[model samples]
Target: MEQTWRWFGEQDPIPLDHVKQTGATGVVTALHHLPAGQVWQPEEIAKRKHVIEEAGLSWSVCESIPTEDSIKRGDANARRAIDTWKDSLANLGRAGVPVVCYNFMPILDWTRTDLMFRLPTTGYALRFDMIDFVAYDVFMLKRNRASQSYDPLLVEKAEQRIAGKSEEQKKLLETNIIAGLPGGASAQTRSSISSLIESFQGIDDETMRGNLFAFLKEIVPVAEEFNVRLAIHPDDPPFPLFGLPRVLSTASDIRRLLAAYESPANGITLCTGSYGSRPDNDLVAITREFAHRVNFAHLRNTTVEPDGSFYEAEHLEGDTDMVTVIELLLREEEEAGRQGRRPRIPMRPDHGHLLAGDIDRQTNPGYSYNGRLKGLAELRGVIRALTRGI
Candidate 1:
């Protein structure tokens, strides 16, 4: 359990020095200024890594190197784009960055209905209210045949939820739902979102998975050559969104993904919060089953309601049993060491709440320092306790 903090680059309000002060030795960051289809210049990679090293932190993982829309579409331009991506990986590997995390969720990285759900304790947290999402999809954004995606009772409930809102609430929901925040990865104007949905009309889950398999076949060899582990993040919410297909959401999906290529370079990000959104995904079991190929981890929890609504719960407080999960990770690491192939997985606290008067101050929802500091502290304690008698 190497502690790493996600840094968004030089523009991030939480600077590199601030991250070092959090007692994390590793920095998880990206070359965000570079556009999606271009190769990350070696000079640029060196510059960011030098900054982190100067702050007395090791550059441990690449939080992302975004896959362009052309790649996802498998358009003619995608071949050149993936070549650029390969060049970028070579640059990062040459600079000694060991892990790269990326996701294939089409058009958007993650989706949430509300960024500031006022919690019962007066703090604010990011929430995914399924009914509100349904309302937006059905009557607000009004995607074609969006009603088919939700159950009849759920659609009726969404209608009720939206009916009571004033005009202001409706506008805010639309803005938060589609317009996105300042530095967040998604950019979707209403028309753009509509166009994006239209683009996915003929692509089903099978086709999307096939595209991803083709992608890994092209990229994993580069990763292998450079000793960089490319870890694909599971779909956030771990399910379909806006009627678009999600290929990386389940344990079986992970099995299939690894089976696509026999290379260890084709691996997973192993996001517990994403997979744990469904009650059936046992976190301990998942770690044991996929531990060898898990190169990165987003350790967090979610509290799911019956209707598919969920909210980010405190790191050690939700449905995921942190104690058991930590123990299992340690056990797996021990087993791997016996085979003389010990791997150190990089993990960070994903999606913390906006607590302690921070919600009104315009921070990235679930990315404020206070909540993540709390989460890291708790997870650190859990790791400490689990490893004490080993």
Candidate 2:
């Protein structure tokens, strides 16, 4: 495993020098300034890569080459997007970046109702409470047929949660949920959000799945030609949000996708935090099953609450079996070595809570330093223990 840290280029509060000091040799980043659907120019890639190299780190993974909305919607612009995506891959290859992480979810990258949910011991952490999310969908965002997304008991809980809110709290929660406060991007206005939610009206789960496959079919070959591995990130909650259908939220989704394309370039960015959100996802088994296809990874853990809420836990203390998962990854690396494959998978401590003195400040949700440094420390110890025993 190649330890990496995500840096948001020049604007990142945590500089590349700080990342290098963390014992990570790779930087996972993207052209955050580029709008979606645009090609990443070669000059931009080279400039970023040069910065990373100058900092004694390699730009190991492009954290994403965002899938265009046209591709997600399967609209007339899909073909153009397929071409543009190929061009981006070529640009990355030209810049010597080999692995790219991306996701195919329709509306949002990831959603959480609470960006600062206080943990029992840790000061505050990112969280997704099912009731809170449903409350936002049913009462706040008011998505169509949002009522149908939850069961009766969940609906009851959601209503209670909504009712419990004060007017100001209600406004804040609505802003937090739909305003995309933590998108690490600008917040969308109420009208824009409404229009965005309305856009998913007819795009059901199956339709989204079809679009994803169409997308893979279109670009996987180009990725293979460029010696780039395109790893699709799993949905953050491993489920739908706001009545939107999430296709890459399960193990079966990855299995079907790999079988569909059967290309070495078609890969998975296996995130323990994302898949571990679902209790049924047996983290170790999924890791072993998809071992051959995972070219990138995000190792973090979460503790799930009964109400479908979950908070970031100490990397090794959450719902994921961190020990077993890492052991499997090491075993997979051994196997890959036997098969003559280089096993340098780029991974980072996915989301770390705000702990220590970070509680008072507003950091990018989940990208805080203190907690993630703690997580990386723990994970490093775990990896060392596993390797020593092995």
Candidate 3:
């Protein structure tokens, strides 16, 4: 697989030079400054591309062309939003960036209750504790019917967790969960996010699935026209949240989506951390099953509990079978190589633990340099070992 890093352009604390030092030759990013559903003018794409090339790296993937809320909810502006999204894809393709990652979840890109949950040995990792989340949902954000989402016992525990916190701690918890993580796709304050969550009260899982299909039906053809691969990122946590339905969480979900368009341009960004949050999503099997449909990858792991909570783990040491997953990807690449097709998928170290000097420095929540460097080094070792044996 080709190694890449997610770069946040000029403002990133870990600049492109530092990314080059990590042995990543490609970058996965987007015009985060642009609002969702707006056209990505070719000039903007070229400027970002120029910066990456100057740093001796290619912009391998546009980490996203964000889906508009109107499109996801099938509101009146859906057509205009999707048209803008398609326009962005066409311009990206024109700029010679072929792969674009996107997501369809109604609200939030990814949610975690703890940004720096301390570990016994390796420092801190991003975490999602059910109690912490439920406390926010039921007691803090006070989303409608949030209490019903959890079991009666879990709801009680949420109450206890909320009761045990200081006011300052409660505010921090809410901000971490809602203000969005570093480089997150969506962000809002407590009032705005709560209202956004409430807006989807009438939309059920089936309706959400239909909306996703409606989105793919319109955009997939544009992707094909531009020769761009639309790699839809799996819903983080792989489940519903804030009472909103999440469609792209399981293997069957991808299969259904592939069937929706039945084209190579319609692809999956197989994020291990996102799908791996669900214990039932066998990463190896899913990799094999959807080998040809995958256009991008985000290789990371999580230590998930039997309950829905999980925390980011060392790239290889979490709940996922990282070895088998990478082995499968290598096998897929090898097969593609013999067929004269794109041989390797583009991937990055999704998230890394904060270690050593990083524990004290003010770094982007999960984009700490030292930890990701360690992660990329470890992953590169696995790639080399597998190659040597082969």
Candidate 4:
């Protein structure tokens, strides 16, 4: 495993030099300024690569080239969106970036009601309280069929959750949900979210998945043509949200995704945090099973509540068996080398606790400098120990 850091272009509060100092030799980033459904020029790709190299880091993975909503919903503009996606893949391959990471979640990329869920030992961590999200979805956004989306008990819990929140706290929740993350990824508001979820009226999980396969049918060949690996990231929280279907969630979903194109270029970004959010997902088994098709990895862990609420835990402290996961990946890399398919899988610490001086500074919620630095160091040590043994 090659250690990589996700840097959000030049304007990121954390500088490139800071990344280099973190001992990450590779960078995972994207043309964040570009709109979702646009073609990425080869020149732009080269420029970003050059910028990364100039900072003493190689560009390892394209963190994302956004999968436009049009493609996911299989709308009229899907063909154009997919064409643009292929263009970007080609451009990336030409520029020598090996992996492209993306997701197919609707409306929001990743949702969290609490960005600063505090732990006594670790300071603040990102949290997704089901009750908070349901409260927002039902009472605030008031999406069609929102109540039906939850069980009676859960709906009551959400009602109780929101009923207690003060007006200021409620506003904060809305802002956090809709303010988006860094790199110009916009968020969905009450009005826009409802309108967007409406687009998927007739689309169910299987239908949406079929649409995903249809997308791969066109783009997978382009990826193979350019010797690029298209790594689809799993859905964050790995479940349905706001009555919309989430296709990329579990090992079963992973099997389906890989089976779609049956090509090496078609792959998965094995994100432990995202998949591990669900208690059913065995992180070690999933990583081992999809080792051959894994193009990139996002290594982080979370502690979950029985009712599906979760908060980011330290790299080594959460429910996920971090040592086993890393060991499996190291063995997978070694096994790949034994065959003719040796590949340096790029991985980054997915998200981290916002701790120390990072709390005082302006920071992206899950992307604080200090928090991820701590995570990367912990993961790097584990990787080093495993590789040295190997």
Candidate 5:
């Protein structure tokens, strides 16, 4: 495994010099300043690459190049959006960046209802409370047909929960759900989000799946031409939200994706936290099955509640079997090496708890320096122990 860190370029509070200290030789990032559906000019890509290289680190993976909503909805602008995405992909591949991780989730991307859920240790972790989310959908954003998506009992509980909150608390809840997290899509206001949800009114799971496949068909060939591996990130929370369709939440969903566009360039980003949010997803099995097609990995864990809510857990402490998952990845790497292929898979510690000195500083929601440093150190220990027979 090639250890990497996610660095939100230039504007990030954590400096590149600090990243070098974390023992990660690679960086996973994107051109966040550029708006969605815009072409990534070659010069901009070179500039970002130069900065990462100057810091004694390599840009191992382009975390994402923003799959625009136009493409997701298969709207009138989708053709232009797909062409721009291909242009960006070619530019990245020209720069020698190996892996490109992206997602096909419509509207929102990797949402959470609580960004600062305090853990028992007094540190904060990202959380998704099902009741709180349902409350937000039904009472706050007021998406049409939102109440119908959730269980009747859960909807009743959400109504009760919303009735008890003050205005300030309600606003914060809305912000957490739609204000967008670090590296996510642009923040959405109540009115804007409602309209976005309305735009997808007729797009169901099957429709959304078709749109994703159509988008892939156009871009995967470009990726293959440029020698870039396209890895579709699993849907965060691994379920539907805001009455939107979810097509990348389970093993069956992934099987369909890989089969739709058969090629090494058409792959998956094995994010343990995203898939592990659902108990039905067997992480070890998924890893073993897709090991050859995994272009990147986000190694994090989550402790899930019975009600479809979950909180970020220590990298090795959650429901996921970290040791076994890593063991399978290493075995896959060994086999790839035997076949004269690139053996190192770029992986980063996905998210970490806000702890110690990081408790007071203003940092990106789940991306504080001290927190991720601790996670990387723990993961490094595991990788070393597994490989050296220690």
Candidate 6:
């Protein structure tokens, strides 16, 4: 595993110098200033790479190169979007970046109802409260047919939850749900979200999955040609929201995705926090099965509740057996080495808790520096311990 850190470019409060201090020699980032569907020029890619190199860090992976909504819907604009995506892929490969981690989630990306869910340790972690999300969906955003999306009992609870929220609290909930967190495709307003959902009116899961396959069929070949591995990130929370269809949420979904284009370029980003959100997803099994296809990994953990809500947990302390997961990944690397392939999977500590002085400073939600540094240190310790005496 090559340790990497996700940086939001120059605008990120945590600068590249700070990243180098964390002891992660690789940086996973993107040219976030560029909009989706636009080609990332080779010069721009080189420039960003130069910046990371200057900081004594290599640009190991592109965290994302935003998969535009048009691509996800497979609508009229999808052709243009796919072409531009290929152009970007070629540019990135030419720049020597190997992995690209992207998601196909419509509208929102890695959503949560609470961005600052305080943990028992007094540190804040990202959280998805089912009741809060449902309440905001059915009552706040007021999406059409939203009530029909949830269980009757859950709907009742959401109604009660909404009734208790003050106007200020309701606004906060709306912001957290749609106003966008760091690395999301875009920040959306209520009207924008409604329009986006309406745009996908007739597109159900089957239609959405078909669109994703169509995308892979066209793009995977280009990725393979460019020597770039396309790692599709799983749907955060691993569930549908705002009645939108999610194609990459479970192990079955991943199986279908990989089968769509059977090539080394086509792979998955193993995000434990995202896939582990669902109790039914066997994280260990998923890792072992997809080890060969894993181009990148987000090694984080989460504590799931029975009601579908979950909170970011310490890197090694949640529902996931972080040690076993790391052990499997190590074995994969060892096996690849034996086969004359040096596939060093790039991993970063994701969605860390807001601890110490980071709580008072202005920081991207779930991306505070001190918090992630703590996570990386812990994960590094695990790797060392597991590899000891081997």
Worst 10 residues of 1 by lDDT: 179-188
Residue lDDT tens for model 3, 90-159: 9999888979998887777888888989998858999999889999989988887788888999999889
Pick out the ten consecutive residues of candidate 4 with the lowest summed lDDT: 179-188
lDDT value for candidate 5? Answer: 0.89
Point out the higher-scoring one by TM-score: 3 or 6.
Answer: 6
Candidate 3 CA-lDDT value: 0.86
Q: Rate the local accuracy (lDDT) of all candidates.
A: 0.83, 0.83, 0.86, 0.86, 0.89, 0.89
The clash count for each model shown is 0, 0, 0, 0, 0, 0
Model 3 residue 328 lDDT score: 81
Instruction: Let me know the TM-score candidate 1 reaches against the reference structure.
Output: 0.96
Say which candidate scores most in lDDT: 5
**Tens-digit lDDT track of model 1 for 1-390:** 789999888878788777877778999999888766678998899999989999899999997887876677777887888888888888998899999999888887777878888778687777888899899889888999999998999999999999998999987787766633223425556677788778778888888888889998888988988889989999887888899888998888999999999887888897888898977788888888888888888999988898888888889878888778777777766777778774677889887888776655656667888788888988888888877856
lDDT of 4 by residue, 248-289 (tens): 999999998888889988998988899999999999899778
Model 3 C-alpha RMSD vs. true structure (Å) is 1.9
Better of 1 and 4 by lDDT: 4
Worst 10 residues of 6 by lDDT: 179-188
Q: What are the per-residue Cα lDDT tens digits for candidate 6 across 154-199?
A: 9999999999999999988877887463344265667777887898
Cand. 1 Cα-lDDT: 0.83
Candidate 1 deviation (Cα RMSD): 1.8
Model 4 TM-score on a 0 to 1 scale: 0.97
What are the runs in model 2 whose C-alpha is more than 4 Å off?
179-186
Estimate the Cα RMSD of every predicted model relative to the unseen true structure. 1.8, 1.7, 1.9, 1.6, 1.6, 1.6
